[model samples]
Target: MSTVFVVGSLNIDQNIRVRSLPRAGETVRGSDATFSPGGKGGNQAVAAARAGATVKFTGAVGDDAHGRRILEVLSEASIDAGHVRVSGTAATGTAVIAVDDHGENQIIVSPGANSGITAADVDAGLAAVQAGDVLVLQLEIPTALVRQAARTAKGRGAFVILNAAPAPRQIDGLLDDVDLLVVNEQEIQVLAGLAGMPGNHRDLVQALPPALGPAIVCTAGAEGSFTVLDGSLVHVPAATVAARDTTGAGDTFVGYLAASLAGSHRDLPAAMIHATRASAIAVTRTGAMESIPWAHEIPASAPKPATPDPATPNTASPNTALSSPVVPN
Candidate 1:
């Protein structure tokens, strides 16, 4: 099994449950309020650990309660947090989230300590990464740092995966360093400059200019996700369940995908299936890290030989979807 390294953000998510998303300046009241340990980096790291990967996270948080909580959560998930830093000058990062009845969510983030990550921070976090390892990145942190890590990981012969969320108006040269690029429909439309691309997943994915770069995975919520493997586009169906919150689905998918590829099952198509199932399970519950399913809880489609060593887990099948009843929202 290959190790998975993440260089990203760590935030305390302030979530509000509302009947529906409020329009601009509408001032709608939330039905309930809650807080959870979240952030693209932290969420993905937790997801990968739950998916049976040996994971390490690198980022910064404030010398505050939120920072302490974030570290505790990561430790409980068995993620290596040695690279996580505490900033003396800044407050911990935070995200104000609103989830509606349909499970859709809107988020407003305050970078805080997340914006303080320097190139040195990225380098320190990636020191443990080696050839055949998997490095996962996201846009919540500084783009330059993400680019630097990607280059470093690629030079070391490790696979680089980027989830370009909060799509930048213009993609930097970092695209060239990515081995796998993951995005949702809204992001693809903006990043690809095809806001009105009127076609199915196959056409949209195929139409992307080579400049977009990397093998792509385009997710379309309940419609499932699309990816290209072995020169063919494959669609992995999202598990059917009543969604409680969609906040962490994308992170779950990216984390599970990285975990799958880091193991013996390097097949992209099979990995996508596993990722999609993990995502489906995520949306069926509320919160981010708390929602991800553990490897033992998920049933794989094809049963591979089990490893005799308890420390190392065997690769599981990708065809099996989540069959358990939905937990109360």
Candidate 2:
């Protein structure tokens, strides 16, 4: 089994359920507030573990109660938290989230300890990654650390999966070191500027610089996901379900995708279907990490066709194809 190393952020999410999202300058009463373990990195780590991967989470948190609780949550999920550091100078990162009846959410983040991650910290985390392992990264922490981690993982021959969320001002060759670039329409737009528009899976893949990596996956909420796999355009439709909270859906998708790719050693298209189904399950519930489903909980509706043959080792050459796009099942 391939191990997953998550180098990112750890945050305590303060969430509240409201009848509807608040309007501009409108203060609306919400249900009792609750706190849960969250953050892009932490959520993806938990999601990957639940999806049946050996996950190691590396990030920083305060020595406070919130930090302790977050660590406890990761431990419960069977994620290795030994690499996570305790920062004395800053508090754990936090996210204030408001979820409406429609399952839509708005989030405001306060990057505290997450911003304190140093190059040394990233170096320590990268030590766990070996060739053929999967390294999951996000932008919740500092960009410099993200680059450092990317370089380290790439150097180690580990598969580098970058979830460029909360889109930075410049992707600026950040994708150069990444093996797989996962993002939504908005994020791709930010990373690629005008080229990233249209946001179609094929278009985004075509627009992205070849140096940014060989494969790209663009997710469009309920509309499903698009990707260029083996020179073909594959679209995986989202599973239908009642949504109670959409938070962490993207993280769920990314986590499951990484696990499927690492565990199954299948091509990008094969992994995407599994991820889309897992994400469909996530939005049906509330909370970030709480909403992510375990491997057994994934529905039968999510197609997992035998491709590249199950008997084959999960190892496949990366970015060896970019032919004309053929529509896949």
Candidate 3:
């Protein structure tokens, strides 16, 4: 199996469960609070590892207890953390999250040490990357470092997959070096500056700059996902499920998608199918990494032919048809 290099952020998520989100100044009583290991980069790396990919993580953590715990968690997930660094001046990244009774969440992040990643960090991480390996990235870290990693991975002939989350106004010139740009509906709108109205998959795909890359994947939540690759438009429907916590669902999809691509199956459509299935499973549980299901844990049988039951959500589905709007969890 090909190895996956993940260069991104590591954060400790402090989550609170409440009856509902607070309004302007109205404070609501929270039911409980829990802390978990999270961050786009770390979550995706764990997701990829659980999906059966040999994964390596390259990011910065603080010289604090949270940082130590981050490394410990990654080790438990069997992810290679040899390239992870410790920042003396900064604290580990953190996210404050609020989850309501409906499983909806509101999150605020502090980059902290994750923001300290530099080009040097990317260079150090590249030591283990090889041709045909998969290099996955996200925008949570410094954009310069993200570009450096993508360029380096591309130079090494490794497939570069970029999950442009927490989308920025400008991504420098990194897209040209990226092999796949995985983003969701809101992100696409932010990058493209299109009207607030929903758009057709083809229309959305056409809006992207032709010079960026050949493939653009737009993920729509329950509706499904859309992919434009090699001049072909493919829509992959999502496995219907009663979502518990949507956090990390997109990371799960991206992780599983990267793993499927790095593995023997090079077909993009098949990879998307597998990723969608994995993400569906993630939504049925709570927490980020804790929600991700292992490869063996996925149901062996395919989904039933009937329309998905909203009440009883199952991630494992049999249908392979690609259809639906792009919604990133």
Candidate 4:
């Protein structure tokens, strides 16, 4: 199995179950308050590890009990935490989340130690990417380090997959070196200016362009995902499932998608299908890393098309080996 480098954040998630979400300035009573491992980067790292990829994680966590717990979770998943930093500057990152009976959620993040990642740390974390490897990144860290990571990882010949969660305020030239840009319905609209109207993924497919010259993936829950790659647009519909907790579903999809593409013969479309299935499984459970599906849980892929999609790899899947340039971290 190829190695996956996940350079992102690690957070202790505080989860509360509520009958209904609170409105602006309204207080609501919630039951079943719990704490668990979380953060986009941490969740994705676990997801990749479960998907059968050897994962190495790099991020900062406070020298505290929450930080230790986060590391334990990563270790339990068999991911390498050697590159993770124990920081004294700030406490471990945290997220306050409220999940309603309907499984919808409201979240507030406190970056904390996640903000301590620097360029030097990025270099140290990505040193082993010289060989064809998979580098998964997210926006939980600082943008400067994110850009540096993209450039450095690209220079080292690793394929870069960027999940632009919590869309940034400024996107100027940030995607210059990205190979694949992954975003959700609202994120795509904010980043690519392509508003994929709810329940209509066709609009995103039609409006997509290789603007930064990298493939783009926009995921819309239940409505499915749309992708533009190798001069073609492909739509992979999602499986319909009643969600119990939708938190971390996107991370599951991203982690599995990266794992399927990295060092595997699966094509982009096939990998997307695989990821979609993994995410469907995640929604049936609660928690972040805890909810991700394992490789065994993923079913065997469907037979290849008589004529494969152009985006599908002929030699190596793009995820298997990205040629320099990467999506933002």
- Tens-place lDDT per residue, model 4, 1-329, is 56889999999999999989999999999987899999999999999899898999989999999999999999999999998999987999999999999888999999999999887888898888864677888998998888888888888777778898888677766676666778887777776553323333344443443344456778988767877443345667778778999999999999988887675554667677878889988999998889998889876753222222454433322331222222212
Which sections of candidate 4 miss by over 4 Å?
194-201, 229-231, 301-329
Q: Which model, 2 or 3, shows the larger TM-score?
A: 2
List TM-scores for all candidates, in order: 0.88, 0.89, 0.87, 0.88
Please say which candidate is ahead in lDDT: 2 or 3.
2
Write the number of the candidate with greater TM-score, choosing between 1 and 4: 1
Clashes of each: 0, 0, 9, 5
Could you tell me how far off, in angstroms, the CA of residue 260 lies in candidate 1 after the best superposition?
0.2
Tens digit of per-residue lDDT, candidate 1, span 196-306: 445555555555534455767788887677754333345666677899999999999999988988887676667777887788778989998788888886766632221
Output the lDDT of residue 165, model 4: 87
| Model 3 agreement with the true structure over 21-51: per-residue lDDT tens digits | 8888989888577888899999999999999
Model 3 TM-score is: 0.87
Model 4's number of clashes is 5
Clashing pairs in 4: 177-326, 178-326, 178-327, 179-326, 179-327
Residue 74 in model 2: shift from native, Å? 0.9
User: By TM-score, how accurate is candidate 2?
Assistant: 0.89
